[model samples]
Structures are given as C-alpha cells and as structure tokens.
Target: MSTPSADESVELEWDDIQSGALHERPSPYVGRYVLIRIDDREAGRELVRRLLPAIEAGHPTADPARDAWITVAFTYQGLRALGVPSDSLDSFAPEFRAGMAARAAELGDVGDSDPGNWEQPLGTPAVHIALAALSPDSVRLAKVMERAQQAYGQLPGVEVIWRQDCYQLETGRTSFGFRDGIGQPAVEGTGRNTNPHEAPIKAGEFLLGYPDETGALPPMPSPDVLGRNGTYLVFRKLHTRVAAYRQYLYDQASSRAEERLLAAKTVGRWPSGAPLSLSSDQDDPELGADPDRNNRFSYHDDLDGFKCPAGAHARRANPRGALDHENSVNVRLHRMIRRSTSYGPSLPEGVREDDGADRGIVFVCVGAHLKRQFEFVKTQWLNDGIFIGAPQEADPLVGRSDTPGVFTIPRRPVRRRLRNLPPFVVTRGGEYFFVPGLRALRWLSELDS
Candidate 1:
C-alpha cells in the first residue's frame, strides 16, 4: 500500500466535495446520536451481552451506566432486519425520548422547556447539547454501536450497508417547530456539488488512500480500500448562548414578533427551512417546504448583504456564492449529512438574569475523515475569524474560542456594515470517533468475546 506524502495530500483538491458519483441518494439515514464514553469498553460489552435480550424485548439498552446522552439513530435497515419492525419508528420515537429524558435526569438539569421566547425580538441562540459530555459511559456507548451494527449485519438482504450513523445528544427547538438542516451538498453525480453527472465521492483527500480522480465513492467504502470502511465520526457538543441571544434580540426588537423574527431571518431560516433570502420579512412556509428552492438560493444575487448577510448563521455556515460563484456547489460536497436533534430546554421565566443554565445541541458528523471534512471546516471556516480577511471573525452562531491558538472564534462586529452581532455559541466538549462497518463490528465483537 502506498501513502501520499504530506505535500502530495495538500496539493490534492476537489472542485467540490461532491464531485463524483453518489453511493446513495441523501436520505434520512444520517440520524444524529450521542455516544456516552463509558469507563471501560469491556464493561460495556458485558452490559451489552446482558442487555441484548432486554433491548430485543423493546427496552432501552440494559446497561444503566452507559445511558448518558439521548442518541439520534439514523436509518432503519440494520435495526429493522434485527426483527425491529419498520412501522415501529414513530411508535419507538417516544421510547427513545423516554430513554433520553431518563438519561438527562441522570446527567443534570439541561434547562427549562419554555418555547415562547424563541419568537421574541432577541434572544441568544438557544443552548442545547451539540455534543455529549465526557464520561466513562462513552466507552459503553461505543461498544453498543459496535454490537448493534454487528447484530444487524447478520440479518438478511440489506442493500446499502452503513458504516455508522452519527449519535448526538438530543437537542433542538421547542416542540412542533421544524429545525432546518441547511447547507447540504447536492447529490454528487446530481449537480448539487459539482457539474451535473459527476459522481458524488471524489478521491483526493476524501478517505486515507483514495485520491480525487475517482470522484464520489460509496458512502460505506469496500473493506479492501481502507481495510475497514469505518468512517470517522466527529462529535462536538456546542452550548448555545441563550440568554445573550435573547438579550440581543429583545434589545433590538420594535413592535411585533415579526421584528424579532426579522432579526432571525437575517440569519436565514426560522429554525425551519424558511428562506429569509426570498422572504426576509416573514417565513414563507411554502418555500421552506421545497428543498429544491430553499437549499438552492443564496445571498450572492443581492450583494448588499440584505437578503442573507455574510455574517448570518446560514450564510456563514455555508458561504456558498459569497466565497466564489461556483464555490458553494463544490464545497457543499464536504457537507456532512447531519441528523442532529435538540437537547436541553428553554430558559425558565424568572431565574434571574445572571442565573446560569446549561443547554445546547449534540453536534455529530459522520464522514470519511475528521480532518478533511469536520476539522477543516471547523478550524479554517467556522472557528477561524477573518478567514481570508473577508468578513467578521468566526461564525457567530456556533463558533467557539478555546485557549487562543488551539481554536479561536474572535468576536468582531461587522465593519461598516451590520452592527453588534456577538458570538452566540460556544464549545463545551468534543471528541473524534471511528464508526465501523457492520463487518467490522462483527470483527470487533469476536475480539471482545
């Protein structure tokens, strides 16, 4: 096996992340979940052995100690084959929620459940677990994922094999409201990432050995390519600064909820897919529903930064045309199929202004390489302020500054443009993981046994 040199790797570049053939169409398979790192992987294995029967009986993982975060499971192929009923998804959702609520109670009070202020003038972006807390339970959770994958692999007739589905700490806005997963790359071969007809997975810098020449490879690669097609899962728990966000909006709002909503519109999308680019004053439900229309439009058409400001959360997360005309299409390929859910709760009504509460989203990204996809976006774009010296520093929505050089999202107001857009999110904890394929899972189970 030949390895590319450091310089060689750097030189390799894809026109867009999705510049090749797609292994599969982007589906709901990308469910977000959070794996609690337990103290011992063996201990977790032991618990899994005991819990298998119980989980089969429709109970949560029997391992009590391993339950720490509410995991979002993506796709049903594996579980369904294990005799898990296809119709049970909606029914099982509550069970999943119950499991999460129970786990949250064990961890700590994330926050209150008031969804009122979200519509108010200004509020700090709501805090929810974008990542899971560091604990011994994480080990157990990792083993659980391994076991689950292995168990599913044994079942019959699974078409598209999944290497791993991202687990995240359950987090999101109040009930009944949709949270849009924006900045998606079009199907690689489908013209979303690159020129139409190219495969989604490009080679160079995608996985370990594959170069960009081949284009988009299968999401779950053949075992021979990487020895184990287990892609890396980047786990990050981002704490949204709720109070600060609320204060900002409340301070700026005039009369109606629409004014406050407009502030949010500047960021694009109302937690839902509503496009502020087209409907800046109010969220257009119709536009939000259409993925073709919503994900396709950008602020580049109106360079004044009114439709979607350069600093807006959506625009910043995905600069699209702001970076360069074709840049959005190309870079969108790198976008991870996110399956994040909100965790924690809204701030209580009368907890005093200074009272501290913890809340955020458990952000998880499943990709071939943590460095190329997650780390590159985080360090170079999201966390790095003054990227290419264009706009402000760092993404105000979810960027964080930890110990200066390690990672810094410097808070700088938009110069000669919009005023006083503070940093609204912070990173509390994070880790990188390798989610293995089902075959790999069986291999690990054998090792564990």
Candidate 2:
C-alpha cells in the first residue's frame, strides 16, 4: 500500500479519497445499493482486487461525460472478515466498532424503532460490505452495476445479502413535501462555499488526516496507509409515514393555504426549498428554485423564531449563526457530508390515505467523527431540543419520542404550539461503516497477500 508523505497528510488528495465521501449525490438520479457478506478472507480480498477499477479513483463528477460513480465501505466486522489485524481493527473509532445497533439507545431508536426490530441482516455481522452505483440514467446506472456484479457475482465465498434501488421523486422533494438536498456545507478545498452566508468548513471535519475546524488533524484510524483519506459513514433506512404526516398537517390547519404555511414552518423551508428566513409568510417558488439565493439566508436576525422556528428540523439540524450568542456552541464541528436517495414511489398529491406500500429514504452521512457529527445531530439536535432552548421539543418532522410531542412556532400575537407530534419517520435498520480512500482500497485488496 502506498503511504502519503507528511506534507501530503494536510493536502486534499482528491484522487485518493472516495468521491461519495466528499460530494453530494447528483439529482435526477437512479441508483442501487448492494450489501455483501464474506465467508472467506481470501475471497473478500479478491473481490476488492477485482472491483478496484470499477470504483472511481477521482472526483465523482470530475469528468464531463461521466455521470455515474461507484463506492464501497466496510463495517468493523468486514475488516475482521478480511483478516485485518486486531490491533489495527481496535484503532477505529469506538462508536464504529460498537456498530449502530449497539448505540440504538443513544440514537433514540427505541419502541418500534429499536434495533431488535431493525430489518434483517442489518445491525448484524452478516453485513460485511456495502457497494453502490449512482447515475442519472438507468442505462448508465445498470452498466456500472453490471461491472460491480462481475466483481463478486461468481465468488461463492461472498454472499449478496440485500439490495435496494432508489430514484428521484417527480416532485424533487422528500416524502414529507420539502426540498430534500438544500443547504449542504462547503468543504474548504472542495470549493463548495458558494453561499455567502456559509464558509467552507475545514476539510478534516469531513475527511481524515487533515486539519479540521479546530485547526488540528482529526484523529485517524491506526496504520496510516489504511486510515488516510478515509471517513466514517452512516446509512439508515428511514421509513416515512407520508399519509399520517399529511393528515396531521391537515388536522392542524383550517385551510389549504394555512396547511402549506404550517408545513413550511415545520421544515423551515417551503415545498420548493425556499427557506423561511427569506420568505416567512409565503412560499416563493422563484426563490426556492434559485440555487444562489435559496440557502443564502441566516438565523441571526430571526433569533426570536418569528420567521423560522428555532426548533424546526432544518434549524435544529444546522443552527448556522443562530447559536452565535452562546459562544460555546460551534456548529462547524457537528457538520458532516450528508446525502440521501429516495426509495419507493412518492405519495401522489392530495392523497392522505395509507397506500400500504413501503416508501422513504436511505440516508447516507459521511464525516470524520461519528459520535460528534452524525450521532450528535441525531441525539442532541434531532431527538432533543436543549440546544435550541426548547428542551421539551424534538425535531417536529423527524423526532421520535414515546409521549405526545409538541412543536412551537413563534409568531405574532401568540406563539402556536402543535401538540401530539407523531414519529413521522421510523428506523427500519442501519449500520456504521468506514469508507476508505482509493489507496486504502488497495490496502484492503492485498490484506491476504
């Protein structure tokens, strides 16, 4: 395995890092996810050896003609399945080694969302590898996936345990009716800081072996060659109850216009992705469609939560400048490279009844620290409201609690609190993984050599 030099440690190795680790998923896309389990160490290494070329060695969308990218990741058990040394294996982050199921309590995966109820093969050692291919067209996506299949199709020792195909909804919004991929943070070297309100977060916040927001190198997994350019990954299968969500909003609202306004305030953004900070009273389709101005607003002026509630899912997930007065809360440290793809068909407009069909998103989060970034957002922000000064409130849209929940919307005359907020999203299953860079893939390929 090739090891980067000291100077290279701080440099952004675009070619070495997996594109999916740093870049957002392309919109208007079709994709596939396949989970594998290795019964033989040699077979696992051989699969990696054969699949390396199929995996992109550079930026996901660097080439103008290339519209698809394939990426691979491994659970701790996967590394062990490949015969990675115990010392090196133990060096990974504690949370990762524990796996997602073990940390269910911390992630608020209780009641129906518990790990005991998670989908089969997930949260278990049966999941050794995760491979995915995403492309804007079905033909291109299938072509890439075909190459991946050839890598492990004939390997008797490698078993395909599960697979899911995802696509962009016609509405281009999440199942809950809000723009899905708005307001992603920019990484320092990646040139993602297009929004004037956002500064590129330090690279180390997302990639290993680089100086982070704290101006220090993030702690890398042991064995420099294996850890450098790698990042922790979290993928959860969240099942959204679209019908219930709509019914609740319909029940709370007296009219269709009020219903739309209620939904926008809940997500801090309009159905078209327009942020409430810019258009508080109404949905601005033009502003929501503009990439330049949609995500340009801030919470500094709306600290009182009149425009956008402090407890809105988006606001709580990313406070931006809203928490500046606290001084102790640094939003950058908790930021991660998050992307998701929708599975199942979008619930048709004006329908509020259960279709009895499974539909939701497969959320993929990439970052250097699982505990601080992904888990922190899940527990401290999404599942708890202490950070936003609403201790009793969780994220109104996605928050999961046993008792009846309350969502506060600060407004003129009187503050409105929506009570009995149900868990609109349920955890189907998930796992923690380490997505290694191109060089690290080579390292895994030769593990049995």
Candidate 3:
C-alpha cells in the first residue's frame, strides 16, 4: 500500500454518499433493522425506484431530533435480483460476492458460525436487502417503519423476512455493563467531532473513489457512477452472556473493587468509559465523560503496556501509534467507523448471576475496503496476539474462545494473568451489504437487463 501525502485535500461528494455511512448522526434512541429478499426481478427494480426518494443521502447537516432517517443496502444477490449487469456485478470485491457466511472462519466464527444456527432470514439465501430506520424516539421510529412497510407492501416481490429492534439503554451501558460506542474514528472529510491529537484519516479510507491511507484508490465496482461514493457494510448481531460475564468477574476477583478493576483491565477502560491509561489506579467518571480527554490518550506514553495492557480489548482493536514506532504497520490503514447499538434490556444493578436474558449489541462496521479494514482487524488484531507481542492471548472482551483463553496485564514486579476465559460474546447472525451512493441507488433502480 502506497502512503498518500497528508497535505493533499480531497473534496467529498456528500450528496452522493449514504448519510448513515459517515455522519455521527443522532444516536437512534429507537431503531428498527429489517432484512428482506427479492423474489421478482422486475418488482424488485420497481421497489428500488419507488424507495429511492426515501433513502437518506449524506449532507452537511443532520437533525435526528425532528427527522427520522432510513438507510438502504443490498447484498450481492440483491443486486443480481434487481437486474444489475453482469460486468458490474463481477466488479465487486470477491468477499462481497462470497458473502459473510462463506468467510466465517476468517472472522473467527467456524464451529458455531454455520448458517443453520443463525436467526431466520439471515442464514437463508433470501436475505438480499437490509433496511435500517433510526429515530430519536420510538414514536418517530414507528412512523418511519410504517412508511417503510407501506412502501414494501406495494411490491409483492419484496419480503420482510427478519426484524430486530435496538434501543439505547437508560444506563448508557451495554449488556456487559461497559459504556458502549465511545470510541469512533474521525473520517477526514465527515466534519464530525474529533479530539486534539486524533488525526483525520483520508476520505477514501471509508468512502470509495477517495485516496486511502496507502495513497491509492481502493478497487471500486464497475461504472464509475455506480461504485463511486459507495461503501461496504458489515452487520452483526452479537449475543452477550451477561450472567456468565458477571460470574467470571466474581470468580476471578477477591473483592468488589478488584472485580471492577479486573473488568476495566479486560476492556481497557472503566465502566464510565475512562481509559486505564489515564486513570490506571481507579475509575475516573469525570474523565470518561469528557470526550476531549477520554479518547485523546495513546499508547506511545506507556509503551510497556503498564498503564493499559497491550492485550486489552481496546488496545488490540486500535493500537494507534503503538505499532507505528517500528514502522511495521500504520494504524490508520486498518481503522473502521463503528456504529454499534445495544439490543436488549440492561441487566438490573446488583444482579450478580445469570438471568437467562438475551442481550448484546448490534454491531455495524462501515468502510471502503472490507478486506483491509474490517477483515484485517477481525483476523489479525482481534483474534491473534503475535502482533501485540502476546502470542497466546485473544481479545479479552469479544474474542472467540471455545477453550480457556488468557489475558495478560503488564505490571511491576510480576505480570498478572487472567486465565480460563470463555467466549463472552457470540455471533448470532451477520451479513455484508453494499451501501450505494444516492446516484448509484437511482442507477440500480433504472438498470435493465
């Protein structure tokens, strides 16, 4: 990968890119995700044509407080079902064509990654399109859903096979009791909030047709108009074992304080979202609340991983400049824009044991290159430990662990090791879809033949 000059400025066509793909639009206090399949080619095309106007496009401003937004994405099969040309279809990344299920092993989902175990509409071949409706409140989201239902109802060939409703918890914590969606990368041109030290990455890194960190434009699908401004999306439904997670903390720690500390070490942050690197001795709720400071620290100050363990979940996910000192890997090349939301009810405070409740996060990853950005992080950074200098460890928070796993925490005198860790998160379902530019949506709708 060639490194692009940092001073180069590239203008982004906001109207062409999908809105939800870039902007940190208002958090959907309530959201509805729907997966559908196309049964009739002509009907599907007609549906796209009619739905094109409702699809939100990227813009300089977004006010979720008063307006709801609906974003549409299509699977490889969905494009074919809509009559996209063969040459254009063949131009997409091979992984997109193979689908998420075919690359399950690379994502660390093998023994339990089979489609048979996935939720309805996901494992089936009929899952061709995904629709997400987000609003600031439940009533607004319902209205959006109603409009979507009415539109889809007009087309008999389009079927809504699966649906998942997600919402922000009152406590602002995921099922695992950790503050969620705190760490997000700043896209070079999105104009979203960014910390002082956080450098804006190239627009091409997250959107097609722009120069990536490598200084080269990523491979886009055929027909410049159809592929430009488009990006690949990875949607996953992860189930968290809240009871088991709490139980493990209790079993490992001698006291409640120790338990909290252990949890923080595992996640690389306190429950309040404070990084251990800044407040290593205790949880600092104030610092965590301050976005400017919470995400501003890097591993360069604490290279030995003493402040924040090298194998910690957050560290493993984004090493920042930790691996850059050796000039081995540039952290910017593998960054991904995260849009994850909690799906189930928060476990009641003081609940120490398993309640048998189904709860987790609906993780959505958006990027221009699925293989280099998303897949690389999943396979190399999250699953393996050699890169971080810990060979026998996995990400303590979300790594696949059928057998006992290990988490090493660097400390003075002797390093602390947490052993016998089980898989706290499981992949219930997932899919890869192409979020087209607004113009591309129209192009897809008009395509014949």
Model 1 scores worst on lDDT over the 10 consecutive residues at: 120-129
| Model 3 ranges with Cα > 4 A deviation | 1-8, 25-28, 60-66
2 or 3, which is superior by lDDT? 2
lDDT of 2 by residue, 1-449 (tens): 12212222245888898876765677788899899999999999999999998987665454423578788999999999999999899999999999999998889888778988888988898999999778887999989898999999989899999999999888888887778878787777764454445767778888888898888988888899899999998999999999999999999999999999998888989898889999999989999999878877679898999999999888988998898988988988998777799999889998999999899999998899898999989999998988888888889867765557899998879999999988888899999999998898999888853
Q: Which residue pairs in model 3 clash with each other?
A: 2-214
53-97 per-residue lDDT for model 3 (tens digits): 777775645454667778889999899889888999999999899
How much lDDT does candidate 2 score?
0.86
Best first by lDDT, ranked: 2, 3, 1
Worst 10 residues of 2 by lDDT: 1-10
Ten-residue region with minimum lDDT total, candidate 3: 1-10
Residue 118, model 2, lDDT: 84
The Cα RMSD of model 1 versus the native structure comes to: 15.1
Between 1 and 3, whose lDDT is larger?
3
TM-scores of all candidate predictions against the true structure: 0.54, 0.96, 0.95
Across residues 1-449, which tens digit of lDDT does each residue of candidate 1 receive? 12212222222212212111122212221232323222233433333343232121112222323342222222222222223233442332221212222322222212321122121111111111122222123465455455444533333332121112332223234221335455543222222342122124443223322433334433333334212333444444555666666665566566558445645544556645676667766777687767556665655675546555555556656665566654434554455544343445556532325346556655655655444466556655665546435433545555443222111122235423333555555544433443333333333333322
Name the candidate that leads on lDDT.
2
- Misplaced by over 4 Å in model 1 are 1-178, 186-227, 257-262, 326-329, 347-357, 385-392, 401-423
Model 1 vs. true fold: TM: 0.54
